[model samples]
Target chain A: GIQVEQSPPDLILQEGANSTLRCNFSDSVNNLQWFHQNPWGQLINLFYIPSGTKQNGRLSATTVATERYSLLYISSSQTTDSGVYFCAVIPFQGGSEKLVFGKGMKLTVNP
Target chain B: DAGVTQSPTHLIKTRGQHVTLRCSPISGHKSVSWYQQVLGQGPQFIFQYYEKEERGRGNFPDRFSARQFPNYSSELNVNALLLGDSALYLCASSLSVGTDTQYFGPGTRLTVL
Candidate 1:
């Protein structure tokens, strides 16, 4: 089983501030994604970056497969951005495609 | 296009009872997976079905089961549910079985007493 660890278990910031969240996995991954669990308990896909860099609006993500780590950046954060950010991945091993999710980083953006 | 949809947004049951949750995946998506999200914890994989076949399963007990229909819709059934079975059940659909992006539904909150 692959272990996923997220840094900064909890974060609080003022609106418009920027923050970085990191995810470290214990194994190589062929599928990696970032998700946002909103207040309503809906899991929203943020980024599906297995490698390289991708940006969506004020949010961006970068994954280094070799290092087995990924970073999610939120710029100009808004009150709506307050949610649990999670990193999920499937190991590159054969016949193993189950997505293992990290415990998540809880972020609170105050208006 | 409509995203993944789940039925009975909320449900309440008692221990030793059985409950079934339904999910309709996005159009053209043939893979449906189920996950359980306990309070204060991340979602845990339960089962993955592709082309109406069981592709993968997690560490859940035998009491948990799921099946995919011809239309790619899915149902998760739990038998002899225990108090620990109380959690949010989420269904996700992907274009293909493995290594594809999965779009999740709003999830059904199950309360087992």
Candidate 2:
């Protein structure tokens, strides 16, 4: 079983601010992704970066697999971005292919 | 295209009862997985099905079960539900099994009394 840990469990920022969320895994992962759980409880995929960096709009993510850590960056935050940001990962071995999710970073962007 | 769709967005049941939650994956998807997310917690995996076969299961109890249909749709059935069973049950679908990126439905909010 793999263990996932997310930092800044709770975060609050003013609109237009930037923040960085980090996720550290206990083992190597073949796949890693960042998800946004909106207010409606729908989990939206943010980034699917197993390694290197990816940017989508104002959101970006980078995964350093060798270091067993990943980061999600939210730039120019908006009210709509307020929600729980989660990091999920699957190990290289196909033990279950089930995602091991971190507790999540609750982000609140004040308008 | 339609994303993952779940039936009965909300539900309420009593303890010791049986309940079933349904999920229809996106078209052309062959893998469906079930997860339970409690209040203030992240989603926990329950089961994973691919090509109408059980591919993997989580650390949940035997009372929890699920199956995938030929069309890749899936159902999660819980027998002898407990108060602890009250949680938002989420169904996710991916192009294939063992993929980390998943598209999740809105989820069914189950409240047990």
Candidate 3:
């Protein structure tokens, strides 16, 4: 079994500020994804970066598989960005392909 | 083009009762997985089904079971539920098994009394 740990379990920022969230896994992974859980409990896909870096609009993510960590960055955050962010990964195990998740980081963006 | 969809947004049942939750994957997706998320914690994997066959299972007990249909939809059943079973059940779907990005649906909130 692999372990996923997220940093800065709680964060608060003013609207238009920037923030970064980090996730560290205990084992090698074949797939990694970031999600934004809205107040309604919907897990919205943010990025699917197993390695390397990717960006979508004001959001970007970089994963260093060799280092077993990843980072998600949000710039010029909006009040609507207030929610929980999660990082999930599929470890390179024998026959299982389950996505293990980190405890998550709660972000509050005040307008 | 639609994302994963789940049925019965919320449910409440007494201990020892049985419950079933349904999920429909995105069009053309062939893998579906189930997870349970307790309050203030991350989601835990329960089961993974691909092309109507069980591919992987988590640390949950036999009380939890799931099956996939020919159409790639899925249903998760919990038997003789306990108070600890109360949590948010999530359904995720991907284009295929291994290494694919899994998109999740709005989870079903279950409360066992």
Candidate 4:
């Protein structure tokens, strides 16, 4: 079983500010993904990055497989970005794809 | 194209009763997985089915079971429910069984009385 830990369990940022979130996993993972769970309980997939770095508009993510950690960057945050961000990982065991989710980083962007 | 669709947005059941939740995966998706999300916690994996066969299961008790159909649709069955079993049941579908991104449905909110 793999353990995923998310840092800054809670965060508050100004609308135009920037923030970074981190996720550390205990073991090697076959896959890693970032999800945004809005206040309405909708889980939206943000990125599916197992290695390397990816950017989607104002948000970006980088995963260093060797270090077993990932970082999510949000630049010029907006109020709509206020929600819980979660990072999920699948361990490299028998091709198991069951995601081990971290507690999540709760972000609040205020106007 | 439709994403994963779940039946009955919400459900209420009594203790010792049986409840069944249904899920229809996205078109062309061959993998279906079930999870339970409790308040203030992340979704916990329950079962994973691929090509109509059980591929993996979580730490949940045997009272919780599921199966996939030939068309890749799935159903989750929980017997002898308890108050602790009340949570949001989420069904997710991926392109394949392993190491793929899962698209989740709106989920079925179940409350056991």
Cα RMSD to the true fold for all candidates: 0.6, 0.9, 0.8, 1.0
Q: Sorted by lDDT, highest first, which candidate order results?
A: 3, 1, 2, 4
All candidates' TM-scores?
Answer: 0.99, 0.98, 0.98, 0.97
Q: How high is each candidate's interface RMSD, in Å?
A: 0.8, 1.3, 0.6, 1.1
**What is the Å distance of residue A49 in model 4 from its true position?**
0.5
lDDT of 1 by residue, A13-110 (tens): 99999999999999989899999999999999999999999999999999999999999999999999999999999899888767899999999999
CAPRI-style grade of the A/B interface in model 4: medium
Model 1: per-residue Cα lDDT at residue A53 = 99
Error of 4 at A32 (Å): 0.3
Put down candidate 2 lDDT per residue, A49-98, tens digits, no spaces. 99999988898899999999999999999999999999999888856588
Against the native chain B, each candidate's TM-score is: 0.98, 0.97, 0.98, 0.98
Query: Using TM-score as the measure, which candidate wins?
Result: 1
Cα error, residue B10 of model 4, in Å, equals 1.3
| Local lDDT at A83 for model 4 | 94
Using DockQ as the measure, name the better of candidate 1 and candidate 4. Answer: 1
Give the CAPRI class of candidate 1.
high
Worst lDDT 10-window in candidate 3 chain B: B94-103
lDDT of 2 by residue, B61-87 (tens): 999999988888999999999999999
Q: How do the residues B45-94 of candidate 3 rate in per-residue lDDT, one tens digit apiece?
A: 99999989999999999999999999899999999999999999999999
